[model samples]
Target: MRLAVIADVHGNLIALEAVLADIARFSPDLMVNLGDLVSGPFDPAGSAQAQMALGCPTLAGNHERGLTMNGANGLDALARPLLSPDQLGWIAALPATLTLLDGAVFACHGSPAGGDEEYLLEDMSTGRPRLDTEAAIRARLAGSGGAEMVLCGHSHVARMASIGGVLVLNPGSVGMPGYRAALPVPHVVEAGTPHARYALLERGPGGWSAQFHAVPYDVETAARQAERHGRPAIAHSVRTGWMPPA
Candidate 1:
């Protein structure tokens, strides 16, 4: 089965549309959104409506959880007013994780054990998201009940790692590619390209294999939208795939 995975949209309908159009040519058997759907400076309601129209299963991200928890925080708080009651409810109802392909694949916004906040394949000790050891990745998956493939987002960086023969894949971010955050430590996640990112996964006789795709879209438009929303930092990040100093 071919599955297309997208995550961390964070609004930006233009990027979402462009990515969807690009994915159409591949004609994937399944498409999944890894959530953080409408938590940004762009058109939150529009992005949410468009993603929901895709009719795919969505797993909640940290932003979604934040909104659901308190409805006040970061971009999610700013975007919440733009979304309808139903849209907010839909996002709130999304599951934190999903098991698919009859247990062949496991999907989550972050590490299986830590929900949407943990870094599954990243070691943040350096204050930036860098690849972690296979043993470390395996420990994060320990509570996940092993599968042939594990899919995750939240780091907003495209990466693949093998843990105990299980393939771990992160498709990266769809809308917001570069951003600085103070998590376990102050760090920045950058895709190093201003393109909508996603991943394609397929199961074959040998094993499960994955492909990462970066689709170019109207970055200028997304940037303008962010600027209009009074988020110049997000605008800079969207345009250059690099976070500007605050």
Candidate 2:
């Protein structure tokens, strides 16, 4: 089966729309949203509604937890306005994780034991972040029996790594990518035009192979929307996938 895995859609309706349009071309068996459906420049409600309308299976994201927990740490002022009671309710109702039929487990934000707000950056030092180890990740999958793959997001950094024969995939952030900055950090890809990022997991005869896809959208339009909503920084970052130097 062909499954489209999407994550970190931080309320950029334009980007999400573009990605959905692109997904239509592939016609996968299922569209799975890894979460962070809202909490960005655009309407979180709109994004959540759109995903629900598409009948896609969605997991709870960190932003969703923020909304549910009333701790809007990462959200900007513009994102605050777009959130309504109904939108918050939708986010609160989302499940933290899901297991697919093909032994593929999907977590909206991170590993099962780590919670939804963990950042799984590959370049971190040995014990800097207190993140999960490879053995811990394998232990998380032990309950799944035949499950060989784990899909997760929330770091906004795209990567595919194997831990003891099990594959862990992070599709990256679709609306706002984090690792595409112009910094000297490892795993930092050169900043290019902001585009929608996603993954296509195809089950081959041998095993599952995942292909990462980036689709360019109308960045100017999205930027304009953000600016109009009073989020200039986000708009600027969306136009060029680089966060301004702090």
Candidate 3:
């Protein structure tokens, strides 16, 4: 089975379109979105519509909870008003995690039990995002229900690892590439390039393997949309894939 995974599409339709076009080149058997779908400065409603048209299995990210379940997030607040009832309902119906290929593949926006807030592969205690230890990663996967391959997003960093023969993958972000996260600790996550990211996973006799893709789009156009929406920081991030200086 060949699966194309996209995540953290924080409403940048431009980036999402670019990534989708690139994914078409491979003609994947399945495509799934890992959420954070419509909570950003650009085209939240349109983004929702586009994903709905695809009719793929989509998992909800933390932002989806904020928008529909009353979690406090500024981006959610910004996007909530723009989405119509159908769009809102579609997001609200998404599962936080999904199991596919009859349990061979597990897909979630974050860690299995930690829901949408925890970082399964990242250790943020050091005031930045870094790969966590193998033991720690295993502990996080203890609740994954024994899926052979785990797919997660939210760190917005494309990375892959194999622990105890279990493959773990993060397909990176499809929309915003970087952001300064605040809460458990203040730090920034940057991809260091203005490109839309995704991953293609294929299963063979050997096992499952993944390939990451970064597709270029009209960065200036995306940035200008952010600017017109009064989000200069987002504009800068879209153009350069790095957050503006605080």
Candidate 4:
């Protein structure tokens, strides 16, 4: 099986289109989206519509839950005008998790238990996220049985971890590449370059092998779009893939 996985497309259609164009060359058997789809300074409605047109399997991210559970938070404020009630409802109705290939693959926005909030493969005890220890990752998987592959997102960082014989993968951010986060603690996640990222998984006789890819897009144009949308911080991040110093 050849699967293409994308995640955290926080509403930048340019980057998303670029990444999707690249993925087409692979001619994947299946394409999966790990969510956080339309909650950014970019064209949220357009992004949501594009994803809807693709009809790829998806899981709801925390932003989706926030948009549905309450009319609060910065994301909801920015997203409301862009997405209609029906569109938002459609996104909210997405399941928090999904199992595919007859249990060969399990996917979630965060950990299996944490819904869309926790960082399954990152240790955040020190107020910043670092790759968690093997033991720590294993503990997060306590409720998740031995699935051959597990996919997750929400960290916006591309990573892969092998725990208990399962290949855990995060395809990272397809649109927004960097941002400063200030919940639970203050920290930043950066891809160190303005490139759209995703991952591919292939199953063969040996086992499942994973490959990460970064596709070039119009970073300057994206940054300008963010600025025009009144998101200068995000504009800076888009241009450099690193948050500007305070």
Candidate 5:
């Protein structure tokens, strides 16, 4: 069966819409959101509402945690006001981890080893970066009998890695990307391309294949919306995938 996995939308409705449209073309049997649905450039409320409308399986992202925790450590100030009392209550109700398909594990923001705060980067060359080792990552995924696949997102980078035959997939950032460092000055540039990023996982007799897909969308309009929202940083980030130093 074909399953679509999306992550780190960051409240960019344009990107999310584009990605969903693309996913529709694939005719996926099921759709799952890794997390970070809202709390960025576009409207968080809209993003959350849209996700609910999609009726897809979703996990709680770090930003959602922030909303639930009332502007916790991991959340940025820009996302604070987006959460009304109702939104906050809804976010708080979500679980940090979820077990899908009877055992397939999924985390909205990070791994079980560190909740929503962990960063599962591709490399751990420096003797492991706390929650960076494969074994440690797998052990965390091995909750109550283990899981065949562990899906997560938080770094805004796209990657697929196998640890002890278990697949760890991060579908990248749907609204904001930081994967291709060599792309340009703006880490996530807005070239007026109507493209959104996501991943499709197909499980069949030969095993599973993860495909990264980028769907084009109206980025210019999205940027304008970001500007109107009084979010210069988000506008700039959407235009050029780079986040300025605080």
Candidate 6:
């Protein structure tokens, strides 16, 4: 089976469209979104609508919860007032995690127990991103069993880890590729290039093999859009996939 995975769109519809176009080339068996769909300096409403139109299984990221719960450490602020009450309610209703393919795959925004706030494969306590130890990842998956593959987002970093007979994957960001995070410790996550990203997974007889793809898009337009919204930081990241030099 061929599966296309997209995550952490963060409201840049331009990038999302580009990635989707590329994903179509392979004619995937299924396409799934791991969430953080809207909530960025770009068009949040449109981004949310685009993801919803796919009719695919989409998980709710922390921004969705924050938009509904008035928490999320203010991450949802810019996009919150832009959405209507109904839209906000819809986001609130989305599940944070799902066990799919009759337990052959587990999908989530973060760790199975992290609820969109934790990094499933990354340790952030050091003010930077690093792969979590196998033991640490196992601890995060204490109760998530029966899945040959696990999918998660929210780190905006494309990565994969095979441990304890499971392949854990993060497809990276389809919209915004980098951001300076504020939780656990203040640090940056950057792809080092202003391109959209996604992952393709194929279930082979042995297991799941993965491929990370970076799709080109109009970086300048996206950067200017963020600038118009008064977000220089996002503008910088949109252009170069790195935070503005302090």
Alpha carbon lDDT of each predicted model:
0.88, 0.71, 0.90, 0.86, 0.68, 0.86
Q: lDDT: which candidate is best?
A: 3
Question: What is candidate 2's lDDT per residue for 1-246, written digit by digit as tens?
Answer: 888989988887788888889888989988788887877766666776787777778888766777666446547334555667776666678898887865455444666655675454343443222335676556654443455777888766667878788778888778875433222233343235587898988888998888888899988987887778777777777888876554
Q: Model 1, range 47-111, lDDT digits (tens) per residue?
A: 99998899998999889987776647889788888999999889888898999888878899998
**Which parts of model 2 are misplaced by more than 4 Å?**
71-81, 121-146, 179-192
Query: Model 4: per-residue lDDT, tens digit, 137-239?
Result: 8777655666789899988889998887888999989988887777657777778888999999999999999999999999898889888888898888888
Worst 10 residues of 4 by lDDT: 68-77
**Clashing residue pair totals per candidate (backbone < 3 A):** 0, 0, 0, 0, 11, 0
Task: Give the C-alpha miss distance for residue 176 in model 2, angstroms.
Answer: 0.9
**How high is each candidate's TM-score?**
0.97, 0.83, 0.97, 0.96, 0.80, 0.95
- lDDT by residue for model 5 over 106-174, one digit each (tens)? 554676676775655433343222235676666655442366677888766667888888788887778
lDDT of 4: 0.86
For model 3 the TM-score comes to 0.97
| Cα deviation of 121, candidate 2, in Å | 5.1
Better of 3 and 6 by TM-score: 3
Worst 10 residues of 6 by lDDT: 66-75
Query: How does candidate 2 fare on TM-score?
Result: 0.83
| Clashes by residue pair, model 3 | none
**C-alpha RMSD between model 2 and the true structure:** 4.2
Runs in model 4 deviating more than 4 A are: none
